[model samples]
Target: MANTKSAEKRNRQAQKRRARNTTVRTTVKTALKKARETIATKDAAKTPDALKDAIRTLNKAASKGVIHPRNASRRIARLTKAAQASKAATK
Candidate 1:
């Protein structure tokens, strides 16, 4: 319960931010899942595009402050490494 007006306003703002962050997080998760699935399925042609999308989403989230920059960077790095390893194995 926000007793003060300022506190009430802050609560409202927090709710809005929470909703926005949840949506962005969901998008990031979905993108990452798709990229991993493509890689695991050995769809070499689709893997790069999927990974690119995931990285893009992660960057967007980080830029918007929904995720930490380093967290996004780590995820991007891991996905890129996995894609490269898969490609090498296929060759």
Candidate 2:
């Protein structure tokens, strides 16, 4: 569809970036979901690790430019708050 050679190359690059971003976004979503479920279940053995993994994935996505850093930070804050609440409830 690109009439110019440069435009064609750009389209290719865009396609590659799109695929990469999709995978990263999927990973972030899955991690966040798992952490939320773990927190809800209040699995003392798994909660900390799940939250850590979700935070790490979010940070990686932000650093890779797939997501905004502040967005990731906000999600991390919410997750941490929920984890703390779960802990408090367990005590």
User: In candidate 1, which residue pairs clash?
Assistant: none
RMSD of each: 0.5, 0.5
**Segments in model 2 whose C-alpha atoms lie over 4 Å from true places:** none
Model 1 error, position 70 (Å): 0.1
Give one digit per residue, the lDDT tens place, for model 1 in 1-91. Answer: 9999999999999999999999999999999999999988889889989999999999999999999999999999999999989888899
Error of 2 at 9 (Å): 0.5
Best-fitting candidate, scored by lDDT:
2
**What are the lDDT figures for the candidates, one per model?**
0.96, 0.99
Clash-forming residue pairs, model 2:
none
Name the regions of candidate 1 deviating beyond 4 angstroms: none
State every prediction's TM-score relative to the real structure: 0.98, 0.98
TM-score of 2: 0.98
